[model samples]
Target: MLSSFFTISLKPVTRPIFLYLLLLAVCTGGTTGELKAADNKALAADRKKVDSLNQLAFDQKRFDVAQALNNLFNAENLAIAGNYQKGLATTLFYEAGIYHQNGYDKKALATYYKSKLIFESLKDTLNMAIVNKEIATSLYASGQSGEAIQLYDESLTVFTKLKDQRQIANINNSLGLVQLDQRKYDIAEASFNKALALSIEIRHQYGEKKAYYNLGLLEEKRNNFARSEEYYLKSLAIDRLMNDKFGAALNHLQLASIHQQQGRSDASITDAKEAYSSAYVVSAYNLMKNASARVIDVYRQKNDILRASEWQDSLVNVLNMQIANEKEYALNFIEVIKNQNAKNTNAEKDLEKQKQVQKEQLLIITVGTFILIIVAVLAVLALVNYQRQRFFGKELKQKNEIIEKNSASLDQLNKEISHQNLLLEEDNKTKNKLLSIISHDLRTPLVNTKGVLNLVNQGMVPPEEADRLLQLLETQYLGTTSLLDNLLFWIKGQMDGKEDDKVKVGLHQLIKVLEEEHRMPLMKKKITLRNLVDRDLAIVTEKEMMRIVCRNLISNAVKFTNENGTIDITSRLGDDHCLYLAVKDNGIGMTKEAIEKVNAKQYYNTTGTSYEKGSGFGLMLCRDLISKAGGELIVESEPGKGSTFTIRMPLS
Candidate 1:
């Protein structure tokens, strides 16, 4: 029967309406059987999420577009999980409506087109027409009237062929509104007349009421006051019977305006009062405000100042109430969201508990089965071993004792050889690294010291500038001494290792010596060094090794520190009863790759912040000595953020 009908030309649905109507008509298209039983858990969760999001969006009354989009996303995911193509198309259509309502015309049209294609493939003509109508309405909202008209004609043709009278009436009324707005009075009048006739034929209450209200608008715009009044009364009566407060409010407000125009102040005031009450019942705040203002105007037009003042006060009260209501509404929305989140959280917690319970049950069953199998196997093994032991236990003990002694001797000899080989390899590496350091770091300091001494001995240095040159010479001498100290100790360990001499060393005393040792060089560079280590905190470690470690850490901090930059030496006692000493500098730091290499104990060489050269052995030697004392070295740095090198040592 749908196919027997012919195509009919009609204008498109008006702007900003497809979204409202699409929301009214859409429902899920796929059956529950589309998903397998095993997939029910996931599908059920996705379905719940979709329903929750959709409800939030609807409850928000199009104010929350994000939630609407989120709902559409989950719906699509559910469709994919069930492999339901029709479900996906329906979901897309709903999502497009949301976008269209939110003024995302391009996105709305694209989404609707995707849904339309899918529906067409499924041979769903009704949905295809529906999607086309949405796209056409969105196009109209986007101001593409020519294309909108074309698509509307096509969609109308489809709906007409399907003999969907209700839909036909809707399209006619919407198109009539568009024609009226365009000021094509004759065309708009004809459209509304057709819609009214069709709506009455099908007894579609909403359509009939809408058509009457629109016809009233058309006749009023044409200055037909009596005719407009008749149309409006018919619409108003229908709205009251249907218990549509918003619709009734609109009709009453319109009737009030018509009465005001006809000079019936008393009747106009009555209708305006009724309209404000109805609008208030529906929480139509804008309508209430408008109706209250209209009532005040009707009294003012009657030249009754006192009555007009009373109505004006009422208008002010209505506005004040609307403001208060808006605030309450916002709070209610927040409460709703909070409640939803709490429910979801509780649901997830219950799911986790159920999963945990199932896991425990499975574990118990598995362990019990394993214990039974183990007991049976052990019983047989024990019986066999007891018989074999009775026959051979005495002979086996004497022979085993002899074989063990020889094996122990051979194992001890192998251990000694492996230990010696490790020492040799370590010694060779130490020698190569020391040579590399001495060639640069040691050589330059020694040469500077020598040159200073020659100048002093020959009296070439002036008396007035002698103190300053002596300070420079002293700095050079101290650096050379520190370098030689590290080389001698490292070499001695490899050649003839001895037990570390542990002593209670005060960090304050130790750091004081270090400060004095590096003071000349620091002064020359104008660098400030602060020692924040506690005076009473004493740590037990090899005295000489600890000194070398502290000296090296401080030296590196100062080396990398730019002129006038500050370095801080601080220490803290740790939970492990260890002392943590930090040498921090406010200067250039390390890049990620450089930090990785340093942490990995790879050979990392870089110039200092002031282009000061380094042997790079300072850090490596510090690491080795700290490890020998059962401590750790931690380096923290980033480019332009400065560095902190921390030494962790056992307490005394």
Candidate 2:
């Protein structure tokens, strides 16, 4: 008993098979969607962990940096296992940053380039451009400013192509700083101005801070301390408001240098101390290094020996701590490798023992199996000979059957050859007939039109006579167009067999249109044409094909019909649900011999009762169109009477 609108579908399967399938689905992700959803969540978690670790390492926090490195290695391993290439590259990049921080510049640069290459292969333009910028900065620090400038130009080109305003501004700002170091003041100013303009246009707050800082450095290089101070303070305000510790630290360091140069010892000392504090907050090592030296200089100028000595000792402590960190990092890496090698040695020993035991057991089993195989081989050989004899007899019978099949095939080949020969003969005749018409029916009209146009162009004819010639040309043109249409249809049908677009078509309406189409021709012959088709007599056939057949029949009738002759059309749907349409003309009829030749498809150009010339393609075309419609043409006529062409097709 089931509710009308509710039904439970039943599947016929055993409970054990169903449970196995369910287990298989869970393992193979055939269950609806949750597998990918879970994978995406895990990937997101992995990415987030990697980003966090990278941030900690960037801040240079000692305790957190070690943990961050461990987490980053784990993330890289996970990314590799998941086949996440981009994530793997990203983790590698951060790992390289950690190496750079530990003062392993060679390893850091190598890893950075490898990650950059990966981004390039992936065609990730944004990440590739960023990695290029970082590589350029490292090169500049290594005193390869020329190579660094080249890489910077490459990155700038990529950023400009991307139209990323913030990245472009950042690249421009960095390029200006490098140019400033190289003492190219004009180029540096131009780069800084471009950065500032772009940053303002896009409202990039951090990029604006970078641009302002670079501009300040440029002015300070030109000995314009007043202008430099204004730019530095403007950048410092933006950095503080945005809480960018690195930006704020750099601004403080630049201000300290400016003050020291201006002979303001007390103010320079205050700025240097503040810059050192900011370095600690943002892991700004270079700023802290410069600030330390600045503090010593300011104290020495004031004759403060104790404060200068203290600042010098602080700088030495920073260098010593870095040396100690690098030593520890190297020792830890060596220990991990030793432990892994020891584990591999133990596993190898266990595997060798297992192999030795398996070898002895395999030897014993092989001897027993070998003895059994020999006896089995003899028995199989005896059986195989018996089967071979039987197979030979069967093969002989199959050979005879195949021979008989070949003989039948050869008979069919002979018949097909004869049919093809007949088709070739008929095709040659058609080509000849087509050439005759193309030369006379086609070219004659064009030549007449050309000659008449020439006469008109030369004003060789009287103006009144020119109008009559034009009328004659128009009639000839219409006739040529009609002939071309028919010829095209004939060629297409020959190349690609006719296809059907079937629909119900009323015979009365179709005949009425055809009668209107040839109304002038009928009037010339003084023929009274009547359409006796019932309005309801519709046929299910291709309309265009059927219409063409009927038009050809009526045209032929009008060609043969004498003056004052009558033509009529009639149609019916029989009880068998098939349509029959008849076109009759009371005119000079075809002789039985002539009709037989036409039925045999041997009709060619011939004159009608009025000696009207034609290609005789109409009757042949009627046969072809009717045959394609899956219908047949039936004819009834005598020499003294008239001809009736009837089309029999299916009714809708």
Candidate 3:
């Protein structure tokens, strides 16, 4: 029977539970290469059984979702108990597909993500691509076409890289559907045509059928009914050849609509009855209901009340059966909800534990620093007493002798006190810099990312806005990563005694990275960013430190620059065997006082021309890093003019 089924596998199972069954049957029919190494026959047998159950459930999914869901839950539990990751992911993916088909879009997205994460962790790129494609489909249906297309492109890229022609064809077909809905007729046709070509080349009848069907829809939208009818007929031929009753039902219903629109009552009725019979045999109640309604409408139009009445009774029965099936599905899907809730609870607990550990570590460090400061102050007081005693008189010679006897101890304490003072100052600066960066730059982007993600998850972001937000999200993500890198480098330099790892650093490449990181800001202000540094310009310095300093300078430029302003980054050889790298912005310049503070290595707060906030500690951090790297920072600015922040680093 299985061999016979395989022989007729000309039709591709697309967007239906039947596809899952076909995949599961093929996968479980033999020892999967993924698990063939398992020496335990019993374990393999168990996995096979689990796969079989999934296949059986999928076979019943559309007609009896309740029973199918129950089977899926059992499969999920067994996979969990056996630690069968691939099986578990497969079950979750199928379950999500069911939820999507049932109109539970949000639930489906969540489940799809869970499956995707598992596939990612497993390094199963193919499965991850598959899940992403499904998620995009759901997004498209939910009217989030922009986000959907983004996801579709991401999936396509992966599929393309893997050279998976089948998935590639499928993605093209899906993209065509989205473009069709958007009424981009030419683009849609191109997409469908590409999918068709790929499918025909691969002999993927299922993909071919879908491409034809979508092409039909596109023509129908263009009011080219004759062309549409031809496409539907081709698709219908495939459905019949594949013995896909559900597909036949769909084709017949479309044909009925076209015939009715053409004012051919008899033809419409014939097509409608064929659709109803096809759907009835497969227990596809929804299609049956639609087809029956069409037949009833045609008969009533012809004043055949008896015929309409007969069809009306059939419609009522279909509706009742559909409702019953829905209720059953709802009852079983609750188990899935409970499982998801439990997982969420566990995740929340883990997050809370992590937060608690971070808080405790911070508290410990803060308390220890406070006690060290107190000890340092006490030592300073004793040193002052010793100085006064030495200056006072010979009357305190007895005390003088004791002090002299403890002179080595006092000297050691003095050295420690000096060291502590330096450390305390550096620690204080680090604390201020970290606090400012976290409160201002880091926090905003993270919050924005979270807000955008939440909006996406809730399906509330509009297509145009979502596109903009996606760009913002990417910019914010990269900026956040760069900022964190800077922080880590600075922190490491402060804590570690290792010298700067000097290397040949390309100034042009460095500036280019900063340009990309600040692209959003530059674009927002319509600023022209010119990287005038020579492509081969190189400097021997700590790459990360140089990166941090340069990032701050470019960021400040973008901040201060007004709309339609220009910012130029230029590098030249200095007279002192050093490189002069200047970031010059022609917009709102800094005041003389601000320039003085910057040149003097002092921290001061200032806002951008657009009221963009800054940490005020960036320049200070840059100055410290540059000074350690045998470099100097110079600031030149005046009110209503442009500003230039230049770094002079030794050429060696």
Candidate 4:
């Protein structure tokens, strides 16, 4: 019957025919039932044909062969009747490759491992190598770079022994990328250069381009800007020639960074926009988003407010487009899987009850037709969706590009405005200083002149009176000149941005000098002046600035105090390397609001009890000078109560 069947079916039966015939005899008691025998023979023959087709399809990268082989393996009675373990393993490996090609990495990984174990048991070295490479690739795709590197290394060793230079270069490129992630830049650069050299030697342009791209990234990390730029341009030229959109986009991004560092804002904006556009074409979301953001930053830094705002809006649109594309991809992939599974399940049930003879012959043809139809429909739908997404993404990207261009102009405007504001502030400070000098320095001499003139008008004395008046006039002129000199010195120091002359001065000595200067004025008001400054206390400050601060505080106290009122001057060492100097007076004090205003460093002025007029600049100058000497000026006053002014300075 086997011989007749081979003749009728026009198929050559190979090894295991006798064993299959013996099994048939045992099951049918040596029956010459040609139908059952032919059915068994036909089932084995179909399996062999499926295995042959599967091998051819895998070699040709045709996934439909896998579907046909899978259908044959699912034949329940036939699978059980014959030992199909070898055939099953082969089908599983091919199926895994198909899934991997389709980007179903996790599923491909699971299938690859299952086939790997089976092949290991069967001692299939060639299939094992193939499976390992696929598994490593899946690992890399899933972000397990460490594990992927190890696997790729192992596979590379095997392929190297097999004299597969193409696969070796491929593995080398992948390993270099892993090294880059580990921040082993030098090693990565060496690896990529070696790979590139090998690829050129072998005339593999694709591998050469990939190696150059990686080398460009390594040089960028090393801050070898000129070398990096050269490599990136080379990569870009190659990628463009090869029509590699993703690589081109990445190259543009690197070029943009170079422009940014060189302060070529317009060129940077142009490169960034091109990068974003190219990245969008390839769906490189991270690169696109980053380039968009860089354009925004450049515009903002240049003070181009309009351009900055425009790019910001463009960034939002790019983000939205990326999200929409991801959603569409996920949805399309899920829908394809669902329809395939439903068709597979229904086909399995239909084949289960078929008589073995008919089932074996019909199953392959039936399942192949069904799968082909489904795949065709899915491919069409996916193509349509891809077109839609790409169209919208391009539109959104163009809008963003326009925004980036406008932002560049706005940034320039902002820089101009900031420069103008700085100039305005400097001018205001100069005007304030001039007004202070005129109001405070000139008033003293004018008052003294008025007093002397009143005495002269009375004509109370003779030639001696005229001499006394001249002396008074000379004293007032000297006072006014001293005030003017101090004012001019402060103004020049401020204009030149000169820091104060810090030195260590004894607190006791400083207080005594100030007291001696104010003794006559204090005596005129009949105010008692007490000094409790520690002789041993010392402070680091600008000596002359400190003298001005102390002189102003004591002079104001003397002027404000009532007749017979007491004024106390004291210093104490405080914790944390500080010295506190206090000048307290029993005089007409200030209201709470007035004290607050004074403490807040706001302008506050009032005529003294002795009618001593002030510029209101005295305390402000004191505050400013004290702050420059690393000290603080604080005022404590209450309505109708005494006021205390304290100076806190860092101790030597």
Candidate 5:
């Protein structure tokens, strides 16, 4: 009989012949006497083969999963060939167990159902109950806890009737976890206590450890920190005795979390480190990740940045290991699925190929007929398209001639329209400028004159103060007259569409004239105005335009100058052969935006430091005059520092 078993030569033979002989003897001893007929002997031998393979698979699964699965699949094939229904169901159950252990819950659930159906057909109640428990466990893992609880109850009832204390205790633990998840705390506690009492009664150390760990979780959830620690310590002691590093790691992590909840950070860190070490020893990547993260978090909460950074690196390494493990597990699962279904897949592919061959033959004949029809249609279309192209060609030539003639007329019209638009834009600008000046600047002098006359006529002014006020009024009136002259020149130049008259003007004389023009405001503000230009510094520019630019710049300086501030008008001939006339003032200066607006010749309004009023059109008009004179106006300013307004003009 042992020779017969060896002659079959089952693959993936990790164990010796003696091991198979031992399993065969244990499995077939009762059936050896019942083998009377030849068919009966063959059936018994097939059943023995399946049982031996299943036993071998179970033994191999601990260290070599692929080899284990291969053994189980071989067993499955043997059982199906022999019509050994019980053995086939058992093989499927083992396969599903493997899937569940490897974290393939959906596959596990599917395989479990297949096993359950077989067991039901055979009326194997105990095996069916076992399958139902596995299915429930898989469902719980997949987050279908409601369905899982119902199935668990059915399985628990069956096991209780069979007096299987081990299964009863396991089911109670599983039920407690579901209840705990649903937050039915008291119900969960009762279930966990039952599991604990039964596990202890049976002297099942592993079951007791699991029960203690679960109770620790329950107490932790209820915020009973001391009690949770007690249960976790009990679990830890059992884990140590069993030399289960994985279980020890989980218990330490739970203890660490409980310590953290109670604000015992130091104790929490110690426990977390212990957990990390234990998990590392077992190569438990997820547990190591959790332990490291807990340590990093506690260090961060303590405001220990250095310690946090150090542990964060460790956490990253652990996370990488976890990810790698997950990837490897996924790849192995795919391989397992392919290996399990390879025979069925091959049969289906063969059938599909035959169907595809018939489809292709019919398609080839249809496409050949369709291609002839398409060629006939294309020939007719080509003739029609060629005739249409000839007709359209003559029509396109006529349209092209007409378009050319129209395009010339359009071009002339566009040019005239553009020129008229430019003239209109210039006229609009001149109108806006004149209005701004009249309404804001010119009105001020007239209003001041009226107020002075009214006060004098009423005899409200004292004689001594009246003379000074009248002098101030006379100076204002003269300044207004000068502004009017400049405005008139500007308007005339715009109307004539010509540049202003330019001539060589002494820079020194120009500044001296401006000094006299702004004398009253200068005296009123007590600002010292200096004329630093060399008398020989002269350039050919429109004298009136230069005067207008210089006058406005000086007036602005006087208006903004604080009491006792200074104004300096200087000229220097640059190496670029340009006259740089600058009116620098130690007065309240412009912001960068204000200076940009001035340089860009944009019209804007702002009151001076002395609250002096203006049209805000001075800078625009001065820039226009300077540009027309073939020069550039440059402004530099800093808030509270001062400003320099420079006119750059070519000597030629």
Candidate 6:
């Protein structure tokens, strides 16, 4: 009589408590041979029947499997006396599957995770892998391809270890589908090929059909029409052999699509019709509608208005049928939902009762625990503050001592820095005085020597001896002049505190005058002068200072150029209306070392090409004058190549 009661209670409940009662009853059953056999067979068959019903419910889009499984799970709990581990795991799996089919992926994922934890606790690796694969499928369907691939890989590893080739092939096929979604064509193709080979080896017809279908889709994506057609046909053959009418219809539809892309309109029409016929046989409303639409397009393109219109009407009818089917599915879904809601309502009430009981117990415990914790916290706080105050006092004393020592040291350092600054100022004043004296005294001798040489060259002395004397005097005069000019300008720049007097001057005219003045000297060296200047170019600068800069640059160019060497002077208007002047000379250029020294902020001297001595003050004067004029002096030179000096000044 207890066995009878247990069997009756195992009829599936809508509440959770019955789950525990069922397990207790099953364990308490002291049954011998017949009762045990009957119970085992009934349990196995019961699960199988539920699974079959669930699949049907899903296919028909009922979406009530959650409520159904909850009821079954409750009954199983009662039957197993709350130890319905296997039944609960299976129910959760089916419930998640239902949510997945109904497009409630988030709910499905949560349920799958719940089921996963239970399976893991039970150490059921096989069902765990299956649940993982289903979860991956759900993820892939929801456009989470990357995550799906990782899950599929993990599932495949387990299946491979179990030596379950058929299951591995299924995982491979799923992985291929995800790869296809990700546009990873090569990997997709390899995965499909692996699945196909394994399926063929095991003669797993469903796996082979799926693999071929995936390969066809991949080929179609790649625009390999011929290969796509071949795979579609292979998949169609397998579907036909297995009597899978839906698969057959899908295959024909895909082939028609390929045919249309290949411009085979008649073949496309024929294939599309075949797809419609197959779809009709299977009552696949969506596929029939798609095939009819394709036929209408094909006929319209072929200029068969009558046939196109007929197919168009057929497409409309199929669309209406599809809508009706969807509405019917929606109605059934609503009914199933109403049933689920009724079950959930009852469950909620029971859960509320349990929660109220738990809340009352928890509140009492929490109040007592809170009182104890507050007292402990107050005790800890007083001890922590006392220790912190002791540590802070020690820190304060150390900081005070360090502050006093630093203050004394800083005062002494300040006094030493002040003394050093005074010495540096005095040294700078002495250097300035010396530079001024050297500049003035040197200029006096150079001017006197130049005047004497000029008289000798003008026949105030014997002509034969005059040439040698004049050359020697000219060399010495140039050296002294350059030294005095650079020294005076550098010293003045260091000491002068007045604004430079600026005026607008035609740059081209100034350059022309310099070129003419240097022409005689340049000709003596056999240097050819090429002037490329815009006559309209003008700049604002100090006239006297600019003249000195121009004279120095031209003189240096003339001195450096070898016999028959070319010297080009170019002037142009630059960006921001700046006048840029460049003097280029093909000469015995200075080495990198000499160029570096010449550019330094120190006195650097060198000899001219005519064995003439130079104080290197020419470039220094040029640099200072250009700076005072708000211009830049740039030089480019190499050891063997020529040099170019560019002066950039703002145009007026």
Query: Best-fitting candidate, measured by TM-score?
Result: 1
Candidate order by lDDT, highest to lowest?
Answer: 5, 3, 1, 2, 6, 4
Clash number for every model?
1, 0, 1, 8, 0, 17
- Worst lDDT run of 10 residues, candidate 4, spans 72-81
Candidate 5, 1-652: lDDT as tens digits: 8555544443224245446556756665545555446668898999999999999999887656777888898898778767799999999999988988887778788889999999999998888988898888888888999899999999999999999998889999999999999999999999989999999999888889999999999999888889999999999999999999999999999999988888899999999999999999878888999999999889988999999999999898888888987788677767876876895466457657867997997697567656644554455456658978888998999999999999999999999999999989977986887887888689989998999988988889999878988987887786688678777766766665666566888889988988987778788788999899998878887787788888988888887889999999898889999989999998888898988787777776787777876667677888888887778988888989999999898899
Q: Ten residues in a row with the worst lDDT in model 3?
A: 6-15
- Poorest 10 consecutive residues of model 1 by lDDT? 6-15
Judged by whole-model lDDT over C-alpha atoms, candidate 6 comes out at: 0.78
Q: Candidate 2: list runs displaced more than 4 Å.
A: 1-63, 280-292, 304-652
lDDT (10s digit) by residue, model 1, range 250-285 = 988988999999999888989999999998887787
Backbone clashes counted, model 4: 8
Q: What TM-score would every model get versus the actual structure?
A: 0.54, 0.44, 0.45, 0.41, 0.47, 0.45
- What is every candidate's alpha-carbon RMSD to the true fold? 18.6, 28.2, 31.5, 33.3, 20.8, 19.4
lDDT comparison, 1 vs 3, better candidate: 3
lDDT of 3 by residue, 48-150 (tens): 8789888988888877776787778778766765568888899999999988988889989999999999999999998998999999999888889999999
What C-alpha lDDT, on a 0 to 100 scale, does residue 565 get in candidate 3?
97
Which has the better lDDT: candidate 5, or candidate 6?
5
Candidate 4: TM-score?
Answer: 0.41
Once fitted onto the true fold, the runs of candidate 6 whose alpha carbons sit more than 4 angstroms away are 1-82, 344-652
Q: Give every collision pair in model 5.
A: none
The candidate, 1 or 3, that scores higher on TM-score is: 1
Of candidates 4 and 2, the better by lDDT: 2
lDDT of each: 0.79, 0.79, 0.85, 0.76, 0.85, 0.78
